[model samples]
Target chain A: MSCWETIADYGLRSIGIGERLLPRSDFTLCQQFTLIGSGLIWNIYFGTFALLFGFFLATALAVGKAAKSPFIRKPSEWFIFVFRGSPLFIQFFFAYFLFLSLKSVSPVFDPFTAAWLGALIVLFLNTAAYSGEIFHGALMSVPKGEVEAADAFGMSGFTKFRRVIWPTMLRLAWPAYTNEAIFLFHATTLVFFSGFPAWQQRGDALYYASYFADKTFNPFVPYPILAGYFILLTLAIIGVFGLVNRRLNRHLPDAQKGRMKFRPNVIR
Target chain B: MFSFCTDPQSLDGLPWLACYLTTGKHMAFYASFGTVLILLAITAPVALAFGFLGATAARARFRPLAWLGKGYIAIVRGVPDIAFFLFFVIALDQAFEWIRHKIKCPDWDQPIRQGNDFVVCPAAKLPLSTSPQIWHEIYGFFLAVLTFAIVYGAFSANVLYGAMRAVPKAQLETAEAYGMTPRQTFWRILVPQMWIYALPGLSNLWMILIKATPLLFLLGVEDIVYWARELGAAKQARFSDYPHGDWRMWYFLALLIFYLAFTKLSEVVLARVTARLSHGQATLGGTGRSAAP
Candidate 1:
């Protein structure tokens, strides 16, 4: 098939919308690029949705963990521990099987079998646990003088937290939070590889890259294409997070504003 | 394992459970846990060595060497590690065979890439295609280890680079004032002190390495995930001696418990190590000595 024809037929092949058969021979570069790029949609979807939703949960968890009351603090601490302690791969398997068993009795929760809800739940919980730990660290490390100043100004309870505590927590947490976001995006590649079935060959970027490698017995082209896309994606995440970090630190003096540093070993 | 275990149908209740858990395949399943642990043990040191080398190169005076090292660390961090795992296994396999092909089949004219097949001469095959089954398994495990090392090494390089920077500048300068060479300062003053700062990152890396053991399944190694899936798949009542319904959920649950216990143990040990490393050092853990109040 011509390159254009190949594109038309197989562009949406991952979602089971187009060609049934993958290109078996004479695998074109265009085919590799287009399919892998198309598969990236799933990665972006999982990452974006998970990060966005995980942010709120993480904040709550951080706050809960930092709270003085054991009732509020204990569960959040356990949540963070359980999720962070286990591997995301095992989490995926555990969550998938757990969901599958739950689905056996209740059709209402069957969406767990599909990536739309199931994998997203796993990613959500996983990132929440990670970001929760980061935020907890930041919350604890929030300057004592800032809270003292807020109290001196007669701020108490919700007002103190709203005006002083939360913002500082976020500001201190942003850099590590940014790292967590980037890695969580990267971790989305593990979804299909885990117990969660990719139903109808519908998989993510790594999936399509593997597909091309399997078909052509050539790992050179397709994998690099995926890697390049991910590099761009990582940069994009860094850029967006940098902007937020800037806003978070806008009130601080130039020398005091902690620059966002990317740390890789943040407990993937 | 016992005479009564020969006929599972004759066993009842806890006895059936005992025999079922002691089956030959169950033994293999248990051995897979050892495979996971062995992988972690082997990959950690290999990846750390690679990381140390990469960190050294990145900080080297030579621009080209530094750039190459920096690039290795950057590219690996930027891409998802699963992508690297998928890519490297195939790429490395091809690379090794290509070298073997060049050395062994010098007079052959046919191209190695024929359509989708990578047709190397018989001698160039990774396990010679006729090697014993253990050799194939070992070869697969080796590729898995290499892939893990290449990826995790980049992470370690990042940590070590930061740790190297964190080592007090004055300490090295003091070494220089004592008439030590630059190399001696690095070894004598820098490497020893860097560990105090590097321990946290290294511990974190160790936890990540433990977590990454599951990716071995993706690379086609018969690790726990593979065993879980194989043993948990539904069997028919017709001819199968070990017929069971779809019990993958239970099998995977067991695997989850295994991992949780393993990670908990790692966390305890790493905590102790961090405390030990922090002793006499000016770090957070050092100041909070004898555990937090």
Candidate 2:
């Protein structure tokens, strides 16, 4: 079949669109590329949504961790510690079983057993913990002069945080947060490999790559394709984050601006 | 195991719990933790050695050698490491066998790649295909260790390269003024001073290495994750002495707690080491003074 036909057949295959059954035998390069690219839709989906939602929680967690009240601070500290300290692979396994038991308890949680939701929740909590730590560090290092200047302008409490503290914290944290974002996208590959089942052969890029490897017994082809797709993803993340980074540092002169450095954290 | 633990069916309360915990599978499960520790113990120093070599080469004057080192460091940065883990296991196995195939079956002319199958001569088979199961496990483990070292070696190389550059230029120039050779200057001045800068990154890598132990399951070494899944499945009364419902959540919980404690202890020890290393140095962590001082 032509590459165009293969794309038509499997373009949206990962989300259960177009073709129902995956190509069984005599796999073409187009088939591998199309199917693995289709699987990347899931990776993008999980990474985008988890990061969007996790950002807010991460900010809240950072603020709470910095709070003076022990009640608020202790829980945030422990939450970050527990999530950050453990392996995300184990967290996925434990969360799946936890959700399975909850499903047994009631029908309300039935959707929680599926990878789309279950694994997303695990990634959400995991990224939030790591990003929260990054933000907490930034928040602690926000210059004392900035807060005082805000107070001098009659700013206090939430107003001071919103106008002065929040922006500075983000500006300080963006470099490391960008690193976290990149690694979080990479971590999404572990979803299908972990305990959660990918229903109806719908899996992520790594999943489809592994499937092709299992079929062809050739690791050389599919893995490099997956790596190519991820490189593009990483580049795209850097572009977007770099734009925000420029905006964050817009007030400063170019020499003083913090550039987004791509320091790859190999694993979570 | 208590004296009355012989019959699990008759036992109840704490006695039943105690007997169940002491099952043969539980022993293997416990031993698997040792596998993770051993992996860390072995991989850390070996990966550091690889990193030191990579960093040294990256800093070399020859352009090709520097490119080779830079390429090695950059390879792991763009891809998910799980891909590396999965890829290297199969790739390394084939590479090993392919060399053996060429050497052992030099007279044979059949193509090795025969439509989706890697058909090496039986003589070229890893572990000989007739060797004991233990040999297979060891061979698999050796591949895992190598893969871990390769991937993490890149990360450590990046850290050490940056740390090498972070050492003060004057320190090396002083050694040159004293008529020391470049090699001697590097060994005496650069390497010693780089450690203070490298400690924070290396400690971070160490934590990452600790957390990554779970991926050993994917490489098929029967590590903790494997045992947790195997032992935690619901057991029927007809199957064995221990009958229980699905307890995988609890098993994984135990694994989680173990990692948390391990990481926590490492953090404490690393902090102390950092403090000790920072002493008498001129950086912020050292004497709380500016570099100018």
Candidate 3:
């Protein structure tokens, strides 16, 4: 079959659209790339939605962790600690089974029995914990001098924070937050592996890559194609975040701007 | 384990629970945690060596070797590590057997690639294909360790490379001025001081290593995750003593708590080690002691 015919059939294949059967034999390089590239759609779906929703929860969590009350602060601290400390693979397994049991109890959790909802929820919470920790660190490190200045100007707590502290905290935390985003993107692959069924032959990029590898008995071709797609995705992330970093630090002098170095120390 | 456990079907309450937990497969499940710990113990040193060599190669004077080292560090980081884990284990297995095939059966070769199957000469199979069950398990484990070493080695290379750069340049120059050779300077000044810079990154890497041990399940080793699922599946009374509903949630919860406690203990120990290493150094952790008049 022509590559275009292959693309037309499998392009939306990951979401269970046009194609019912995956290419089973005599797998061409073009077929491998097309199918795996189609699978990239799920990676994007999981990463984008989880990140979008996770950011707000992370912000709330960071604020809660920084709160004066022990009740608020302690839960946030443990939430971050529990999620951050455990392997995300285990979290997926735990969450999957937990949700399955919950579904027996109530229909409210029925959506979570599926991979799209359950796996996404786990990723959301997992990324929130890591990013929350990053933001909490930045929140603590917001310059004391700036707060003092706000107090001297007769600015109240809410006004002072809204005007000065939150922006600077984001500015300080953006570099590390960028790293967490990239890792979380990398982590979406774990969903399929972690007992969250693919529902069909439909799976993510690594899923399709491994599929071709199993069929062709050649590890060299499909895996690299998957890697190539991920590299492009990673670069795209850096590009988008770089733009945000610029906007965040636009008011700062060159010396004051904290340049985003690709330090990989932030927890996965 | 109890005398009352003689009749598993007859026992009830806590004794039944006790007997269930002590079943043969459940014992194997517990042993799988040890497998994870051993994988971590072996992979850490192997990965460190790979990282050390990679960093040294990155610092090599030869251009191609330097590029190769740099590329290894970069490309590995850009892709998801689980992909590498899946790819490298199979690729390495094939490569080893293919080499064995060529050497052992020079004239007897039917094509190794028969459409979709990867066939090799019978004599060339890893562990001889006739070894005991334990030997096959060991071979699978050996491949897993090598795969993890290659993947995480790239990560440690990145960490150590940055740590190497973090050491002050003037120290190297000062050593040269004191009539120290480059090799001597590197061994004495650079290596000794590099630990302080490397400590934070290495500490983070250690936590990552602990978290990554579970990936052994994906690599087809009977690690904790595999056993958790296997033992927790619903069992009928006819097949086994432990007839139960799907209890995977409880199994996974135990695994989660085990990891959290393991990480908590490591955090405390790592903190103490950091404190000791920072003594008499110039970093923030050392300032109090190092400022002594």
Candidate 4:
């Protein structure tokens, strides 16, 4: 079959579209690229949604961790500690079994056993914990002068935080947060490998890559293809986050602006 | 484990629980925690050595050597490390056998890559294929350690390289003015001072290395995750002495708690070490009143 036909067949195979069965034998490079690229859709889906939702929770977590009330602060601190301290690979397994038990308890939670929802929830919580810590550090380091300037202008409470504190906290946190975002995307590869089952042979990029590797017994091709796709994805993340970072530091002189360096934190 | 615990069905209450916890599989499960600790103990210093070499090579004056160092550091930047873990185990095994094949079976003319099979002479087989199962496990584990070292070496190299650059330039210049060679200056001035900057990153890497121990399951090493899954599956009455519904959630919970305690302890120890290392230095940690400025 032609490469175009192969792409047409397996391009959307990861999401259960276009084709039902994956290519079985005589695997071509086109088949590998198309299937693995298809699997990347799931990675993008998990990364995008988790990051969008996790950002708000992370902000809330940062704020709560910085709160004066012990009731609020203690839970935030413990939550961050527990999530951040444990391996995300273990988190996926633990959350899977937890959801499985929950499913046994209630039929409403049946969907929670699936990777799309269940693994997403795990990733969301995991990223939120790490990002919350980064934001907490940034929040703590927000210059005293910045808050003082806001108070001198009669700003207090929410206004002070919204206008002065939040922006600077984000500006300080963006570089590290960008690294967290990259690692979170990388962590998404662990979803299928963990307890969550990939429904109907539809798995993420690494899953498909592993499938190809298992079939061909050649680790060279599929993994590098997966890596190439991820490199593109990483570049895309850097570009987008770099734009937000530029905007965050727009008020600063060029010399004072914080450049977004790609400090790769290997794992979450 | 107890005298009266002969029959699990007849037993009840705490006695049954105690007996259940002492199963043979539970012992292996407990031992696997030692496996993780052993991996950390071995991989940390080895990876640091790799990092030091990589950082030094990157700082080398020769163009090709610097590129080699930079390339090693860049390989892990964008790729998911699980890919490397999965890739290296197989790739390294093949490479080792292929080299052995060239040396051992020099007269053989058959192509090594026949379709999907990587055929090497039996002499080239890792652990000889007839070796005991323990040898296989050890060989698998050795590859895992190497892969971990390689991936983490890159991360540490990045940290060490930055730390090397962060050392005050004047300190190195003063060492040079004192007629010390570049190598002497690097050994005396740069290596000693870079640790303070490198400590934070290395500590972070150490925590990452701790958390990454679970990936051993993927490499087929029968680590904690493997044992947890194996032991926590629901057991039927016919299957074994103890029959229970799925208890994997609890097993994983215990594992989670173990990791949390380990990381917390490491954090405390690392904080103390940072303070100790910061002493007498001009940095904020040194000048701060807590350290006898």
Candidate 5:
């Protein structure tokens, strides 16, 4: 078959859109690229939505973690501890089982038994906990002077926070937040590998890459391709996060740009 | 383990639980925790050596060697570690077997890679294919450790490189003024002081390494996650001694607790270690009052 037809055949194979069966015997480079590229869609979907939904939850969690009241602070601390303490792999397994058990209790959780919902929820909560810890650290580290300035201007409570504390906390948190975001995307690769079954084998990029690796008995080709894709995607994420970082630090003098790093070699 | 555990079915509540938990597979599951600790113990120093070499090469005056080090650090950092874990094990296995094949089976004329199969002579096979099962498990484990070291060595190289840079340039200059050779300066002043700078990053990496132990399951090692899934799956009463319905949630919960407690203990120990390391240094930790970055 022509390359275009080949693409047509396997491009959406991951989502079961075009091909019913994967390229079995004669796996070509084009097939690997096309199929793995299709799988990247799920990674992007899970990473993007988890990050978006996670930000608000993380902020709430960070705030709660920073709260003075034990009622609010205790749960937040425990939540962060539990999620951050456990491995994401195990989290995926536990979440799958939990969701499966809950499926009988109510139809609401049934969607979670599927990788799309279940894995995404796990990633979301996991990232939220990590980001919450990051934000909590940044919140604690936000300059005393900034809050003092707000109080001096007769601002108190929520107004003081909305105007002063939150922005600075975010600004302080952005660099680490960027790292967390990249790692969150990286962590999404674990979804299918975890207990959560990829419905119809519609797995993520690593899923397809591993599939090819298994089929070809050659790790060199497919894994590098997958790595190439991830590195590029990681670069893209860095580029995007870098822009937000610049905007966040626009008011600061040239000296303090929030240590926004290009190389993402931090905690995974 | 109890003598009263002779009739598990007749036992009720906690005694039955004790019997169930002490099953043979459960013993293996418990032993796997030691496997993780042993892997960490071995990998830490080996990876540090790798990182030391890598950082030294990256800082080398020679261009190609520096490029090699820089490339190693960059590529490993860019990919998800799980990918590396999965890929490297198979790759390393094949590479080893292929080398052995070339040496042992030179009379054989076939190419190693023909199609989807990686065919090799049985004589060249790792562990000789007839070695005791324990040897295979050990071999698999050694592969897991090597992969972890390689990947984590790169991570440490990054941290060490940054830490080396964080050392005050003036200290090196003073050593130079005293007519110290570059090697002398690196060992005496740079390496000694880099720990304070590297501590935070290394501590973080330690936690990450701890968290990464479960990926041993992916590497085909019967680590805790493997045992959890195995033992937690529902067992038919007729077929199995410890019959339970899909209790993987509880199994995983126990694993979760294991990890949390491990991480929490590490935090305490690391905090103490950090304080001890920083106590006499010139940085914030060296001061009478505690200072954290």
Candidate 6:
């Protein structure tokens, strides 16, 4: 079949859209690219949704963690500790199993078996803990002067936090937060490999890459393509985060402002 | 392990639990924890050395050498490490045998890549095809270690390079003014000062290395995850002493707890190390004060 015809067939294969069966024999480069690209849709979905929801949760976690009251601080600390302390791989497995166990009793909770729900839940919690820690640190490091300025303007507690502290905390945390986002994107690859089944072979980029690798017995080709896709994704994240970082640092003098230096490395 | 434990089905509650936990497969599962520690122990220093070499190469005067080092670090950093673990094991195995084919059988004209098979002479096989079973396991483990080292070494290189640059220019200038050679200045001033800066990144890298241990399953090694799944699957009562339901979740939960505890301990130790490293340094950790970066 022609490459365009092949693309049409496998373009939505990962979502169980076009192709019922994957290319089994005579594996083509076009098939690997199209299929893996399709699979990337899942990764983007997981990363995007988790990040969006995780952001607000993380803000709350950060504030709670920074709170003087033990009631608020303790749970935040423990939550961060539990999520950040465990491996994401094991987290995926444990969450999957927990979700599975939960599903046995309640059909209302059936969504956790699906990657959209299961993987997203894990990613959300994971990112919240990580971004929470980042924000906590940034909150602590919020300049004494900034707080004083807010206080002089009759700002206190909620008002102070809303206007001055939150923006600065987010600004300082953005770079590190950007790193966490990239890692989360990469961590999406583990969803299918963990206890969560791919659900009709609807897997991520790594899944499709592995499929091609196993079929051709050639890791060289497929993995590189997947790597290229991830690099592009990472670069895109850096670009977007860099723009945000620029806006956050816009107030500072050029000399004092920190450029968004790229430090692309994984915790796992 | 006790005589009474011989009959697992007859035991109740704690006794059954003790017997179950002490079973042979459980022992193997427990030993896989050691496998993780060993991987961490071996990979960390090796990766550091690789990183040092990489950084030095990248800093080298030669253009090609610098590009090679830069390229290695960049590519490894860019890709998901799972991809590296999956790809490198096969690639390295094939490359090793292909090289051996060239050396051991120079007269052979057959291509190494023939259809789906990678045909090297039997003599050219890694572990020599006649080595002991332990040799094969060790070889597989060694390959996993190399892949870990290659990937993590790049990360460490990034950290070390930044640490190296972070060493104050004044200290190097002072050493140069004192007539110390470049090498002496580097060893005495740069290396020592870089440690304080490098410690945080290196410690973070250590935690990551700890977490990456489960990827041993992907490399075809029977790591704890593999063992967990193997032992936790449903078993017929006739064939197995401890027949169980699909308890893979519980096994994985236990693994999760194991990792959580390990990472917590590492965090405590790393925090202490940072505190120690900060002492007497000009940086914020000095004088028992926390410095914000």
Q: What is the C-alpha DockQ of each candidate?
A: 0.74, 0.82, 0.79, 0.80, 0.72, 0.62
Which segments of model 5 are wrong by more than 4 Å? Answer: A262-268, B288-293
Considering TM-score, where higher is better, how would the candidates rank from best to worst? 2, 4, 3, 5, 1, 6
The TM-score that candidate 6 achieves is: 0.95
Q: What is the TM-score of each candidate against the true structure?
A: 0.96, 0.98, 0.97, 0.98, 0.97, 0.95
The CAPRI classification for model 2 reads as high
- What is residue B24's positional error in candidate 4, in angstroms? 1.0
Ranking by DockQ: 2, 4, 3, 1, 5, 6
Error of 2 at A115 (Å): 0.9
Task: Score residue A195 of candidate 2 by CA lDDT.
Answer: 89
* CA lDDT, candidate 2, residue B203: 88
Which order, best to worst by lDDT?
Answer: 2, 4, 3, 5, 1, 6
Tens-digit per-residue lDDT, A42-151, candidate 3: 89989999989999899899999999999999999999999988999999999999999999999999989788999999999999999898888899999999989989
Residue pairs with backbone overlap in model 2: none
lDDT (Cα, tens digit) per residue for candidate 4, span A145-172:
8899999999998999899999999999
Q: Give candidate 2 regions above 4 Å deviation.
A: B288-293
In candidate 3, which residue ranges exceed 4 Å CA deviation?
B288-293
Clashing pairs in 6: none
- Tell me the tens digit of each residue's lDDT in model 1 across B1-293: 97787887777788888887788888999999999989988999999999999999999999999998899778766899888899999999999999999999899899898988889989889988888999999999999999999999999998898999998788888899999998998898899889878887888888888888888999999999999988887877675666777788888878777777877887788778778778877776688643210
Error of 3 at B287 (Å): 3.1
The sequence of per-residue lDDT tens digits that candidate 2 reaches over residues B125-225 is: 99898999999999999999999999999999999999999999998899999999999999999998899898888988998999999999999999999
After best superposition, candidate 1 residue A149: deviation in angstroms? Answer: 2.0
Clashing pairs in 3: none
Clashing pairs in 1: none
Top candidate when judged by DockQ against the true structure: 2
Q: After superposition, how far is residue A137 of candidate 1 from its true place, in Å?
A: 0.6
Residue-level lDDT for B145 in candidate 6:
94
